[model samples]
Target: MSVSVRTRALTAADGTLSHRYMALRSLMKICVKRRSVVTFLALFTLSVVLINTIPLLPKETMRLPPRDLKGSTSKRLPAGTPSTLLDLPPPLNGHKNKLFSGSSAIPFKQPLSHSVKAPVTSQAAKTLNSSNSTRLCQQKCIRDGGGHASVAVGEAEMTQQTVREVSGEETAHERKPDSFWKRRSHSFAGKESIPRDRMRGEKSDLCQISVGKWNETTPESLPWLSAGDVRKMAFLSGGVVLSKARVPGHGQVLQVGLGAGEAEAEAEAVLDHRQHCQSGSCALIKRPSDWFEVLAFHLDRVLELNRSLPSVLRNFKSKLLPYRYISGNARPVVWWDPDIQHLAEVDNDQNSFSLSWPLYQKVLQSRCGARVSLNATPCVGVQHSEWGRLALFDFLLQVNDRLDRYCCGFRPDPSDICLENLLHVKCKSPNDLLLVHILVRRADPSRLVFIDNAGRPHHPHDNLNFRLVEGIDEFPERAVSILRSGCLESMLLRSLSADRELWESRGGAEGLRPIIRTIQQRGTILLQHIQNRILRLNKDL
Candidate 1:
């Protein structure tokens, strides 16, 4: 039995060994297959990398000319030209006279006075005199050139002498004084000539000659003057008319021309003359009606301000006066006022007067020193919460009472008063807090309720949780849409937190953790309110 057990154990051991050899061979085959797969993957990855890197290598090489060639070429040529050297033609000889012949004959030196020669003959002299006179007179006034005046006087004398020789008849026409003064006066009025010798009294008669009569009388009087009488008169008067003829009624007519009620044609002529005249005495006069119109407009605005004072006072008290109830730790809010002293008195509660119609009239009188117009229309008044109403009544009564005592004055027209527009009052005093009040009014076009700060519109829907304080009235549609959309919460949070780096570096209001936390909490509530409102609206729709 022991031998048979031994044979069976040996056979089992051989079978177990054969099984272990087969498993070992299979394991080797799997390892070989895995190694081959890994090797193939590694080789494939390296080829891809090399293929990608090949295009990055440089494709071209450049060669430059030698330094000596470059330097020699640059030195021999002008800048920007190709640097090629070349031979030139020989210089010309015996051309000295050709260079200097043409311009040498003309002398450039100034001639001496005595060396200047006269015209050769009497005809030439006459020609020269006439030509010089004509050139001197070229569109210039007779008074501008003394040479032309002298020539004109000589020609006139010569003409008179020739006329006396030809006619020889002395008549009453010849005895009459010449109309030269009348002509001069008319021409001077037209600014075509200058009136000279006014202060010397020699031209006094000429000045008295009326511009209007001169234009009419010249043609009628010319036939009465005889040539011999004119020559004798000219000889006695230095060959020129000295004393001007006295024209009847000329002074009265000239006075009438200067006075009001002149015809439009005459006035226009006078204005044209005045505009062109070199004299500094003439000036443009402003009309009385225009001046009155400007004054009326200015006073009208002042009156508007005066009439609107009661409303503004009421609004101020209702909307802004309660800011005093806020905690001392709250952010400092400033109010600007036209009168600092009056504002202080009101703030201190020194005035506790009740506001009534009679009191309003008295307060308006005391502040503006003018009667309020009964015809003035009232602006839309404030719609207030309970807190707002109590605050406003107290504020208005205080302001009114203070105005009755300490305020300087109020404007006649509130529209023109533009308290905020004034430089001295702009956002300066506590009473000026009117700037923050948002006034609600009826829109001109859409007739919707509008809220405005000062005069600018603010959108109410922009901040849904934002309660309109007593003074605010105008709200924009876009702002309302934003609030309805529930986007303002995220916007407010981002705006408040965005300047973190600046806050950290400067140590400003960023450290006010309580205010920041309050704002964040308020934003969350606002968002929830907006969402709820939107859902309700959607359900209703």
Candidate 2:
């Protein structure tokens, strides 16, 4: 019985051992499947502990790689450190700072804290803590440059401040810079803003050419200098007269032969035996005041008007000229260009056309010669821009002989040709008034040649001929800009100095000051008018 009992117990014990071994094998298989998850959790816990403990370590142990390393790396300032505006880091010796990479950002050694006392705004604080600091540096650098490279720091700051003020004014609609470059500074401003490529070295415009001191080989400028060629003067034989009317000193200008049988190349000498007067008018045909013509020519060239005929004051021996109009005094000789196309005597006055004042206004509105059109009623073969140019030239120097020959713009003196000829009486019927001295060259049909430019320099300012600019809405941007530039005086003086005869006749610099001052005053008034018009246009828009 004991043996049977012991065998049963042993069987039970063996069964228990088999079940335990099987359970152990299952547990080992489960552990092998979850081994990766267990390892990941262990690593994550380790990292959390390390991250929390890092701030407790000494700063010396947090040192970055050596500064000599070529690799790109940013060295951030310690937390809670105070940094002033524009306080830049020292430049790395051999490596480019990632902050200023690929940019011309100027890093000032001085900080903004030295000058600016305002507390840093929240936006600036955010910028300091972020990468936006790089952009801020770039903008500051551009401001320092003053739209040009290598500007001095002191000047750059002043220029930058001025630019900001100008920008503020623009935003307020007070005024705006006419040019893109002008927004940064005024010194580089231009009327017809030249392209960057074209602005290299210096502008090659007519104004620029008029600059520089003159030498003997080149007196005044090209085309104005007569090359000192001697010629023979003679009266037209057979008692022939070009016109029925007789002018001041000489009834008619004597034709001087430039070369044998070259009648086409012959130029006319306007004889004036009277003592040279600085101001006042002459006869209807010629200027009795010879100095005025010479002054007008220089003024024309200096202003880059390029409209008046080239005239020079030359002293003539009484014997050299025709005996009929003998004068030993200096006279202006005008180039009688064959290229000019003169109107017939039947066309109103022999020197001009029969267009009435109302018709003139209509023509300006039509914009003649701008483009080809079937309608020819308003097309006068003259460019639309030419009228604006003419108005501006006439307003300055107060030359009213062309546009306001009837003395309609201002009060005329008793001795004035317009009043003496009863021309002002025609102003009552302005629609019947005719235009004169509006000459143009056959070669350039669209441009006008300004002749008989007898400017009234002594005209009273209160009596300025505003009627000259009556129908004109737009002026040449280049001319208007020049008027506003304040350089007109200097430029005119430089150009006029080249003409030895004209310069000396006016008694040099001191004598020329008054005339220049008058022109400048008129320029200021015109500029104000232009600004008002521009503002009016903007409001209409």
Instruction: Point to the candidate with the largest lDDT.
Output: 2
lDDT of 2 at 448: 82
Residues 1-541 of candidate 1 have per-residue lDDT tens digits of: 9999999999999999999999999999999999999999999999999998878763221111121222222111122221111111111132111111121112122222211111122445444543543333322222211112222323333222110000011111011243231211010011011111111122222112212221133212322223432332222212111111221322211000111222433444434333322221111111211121111111111111101110010001112123432222111111111121111233232212223223332322331211223333221122212112222221211221121121112221233334334523532342332221222222221111111111111112222212111121111212222222222222222222222322232243333233323322332333233222221111000
Whole-structure CA lDDT of model 1: 0.24
Weakest 10 consecutive residues of candidate 1 by summed lDDT: 306-315
The TM-scores, one per candidate, come to: 0.15, 0.52
| Segments in model 2 whose C-alpha atoms lie over 4 Å from true places | 1-217, 220-253, 259-288, 318-328, 346-352, 371-375, 535-541
Give the Å error, residue 153, model 2: 30
CA lDDT, every model vs. true structure: 0.24, 0.47
TM-score of 1: 0.15
- How far in Å is the alpha carbon of 497 misplaced in model 1? 6.2
Position 254, candidate 1: lDDT: 9
Off by over 4 Å in 1: 1-345, 348-476, 483-490, 493-502, 505-541
In candidate 2, where is summed lDDT lowest over 10 consecutive residues?
A: 163-172
